[model samples]
Target: MKIKSAVFVKGVVGPDQILNDGKHKIAFIGRSNVGKSSVINSLLGKKGLVKSSSTPGKTKEVNFFLVNDKIYFVDLPGYGFAKISMQAREKLRNLILWYLTSPEIEHSRIVLIIDAKVGPTKLDQEMIDVLKDFGHDFVVIANKSDKLKRNSRINQLKIIREQTGKEVILYSSKTTEGKNDVFSKIFE
Candidate 1:
């Protein structure tokens, strides 16, 4: 699964706008500012390929990126942005739910990102439960691993695995840590 080319395809605000061709899709879902875009850019071995923002809620649409023209990496909108209006928040919630449940999307795998230092939150738990109920296989990527103490990082992975019953790959976009393992699991 060598990545020959990674290109941004488009952004969708609704289910009808999503590109669906039965191609294998890998979706990235997480709270706002969880380093989802950064991970994508880093994976492609390029900076700024997928826009990343310092502010939360900057990404409010589902972004589809075509990878090697063989599969798709969908960047689902981030959740838990307190500053957004209730209406907008609800819309985002619906969009995410639609992406996950839509038969057309049919993602082959999902990557749930979480801030390693902060650990998992209530919203994260809810997302995990939703994936479980949907019967979608997913892997958690604990981002910002470079910000955590070594011992604490290891313990956090343990805690996350125990809580979700899924293995979590520790990662840091800054250091490119865990990048190989993450891609391997997806293409494996």
Candidate 2:
């Protein structure tokens, strides 16, 4: 889908009217610093649409962006390894869990971004389990794929696919690699 217009809708920390708006919601989630914002920007063909930062945990709330005036691309807070206090981290974690498990919100799709080179961590595994339990239709995106060598990339994708038991898309925000594939999946 061609993105003619995209704009920031709102950021919510908890339940809100926007969540029940009945728009097709596509949620983006990942570990801190996994380039969730970058992937969103690249996919939308907007460089600064989503705020990406050098420091991890820059996205504290569940931020929603309206894409094509039809769908809501939800940028959720990164789950792990943010340089924050234990209490703050727990709050963020709870917020994420609540959003994912909430019955009222019907997510059209959930994009789970992961570090291509690092593969899925223990936390990523936990998230996979949760998604399964909740019966959410989701996709695994291996971002930062430009950092991997060709041979290693193949092996890494295999490992990630095996671990997640889901088809893994090799993506690179820097090179726009796998952009069309991701776009099709997200909008499909």
Q: What lDDT is reached at residue 174 by model 1? A: 94
Clashing pairs in 1: none
TM-score of every model versus the real structure: 0.94, 0.98
Best candidate per TM-score, number?
A: 2
Top candidate on lDDT is: 2
**Could you report the Cα RMSD, in angstroms, for every candidate shown?**
1.4, 0.9
How many clashes does each candidate structure show, in the order listed? 0, 0
* Model 1 TM-score relative to the real fold: 0.94
Encode model 1's per-residue lDDT on 95-154: one tens digit a residue. Answer: 988888776666788999989888889999999889989888888898989998877977
> Model 2: per-residue lDDT, tens digit, 90-166?
99899999999999987999999989999999999999889999998799899999999988988999999999988
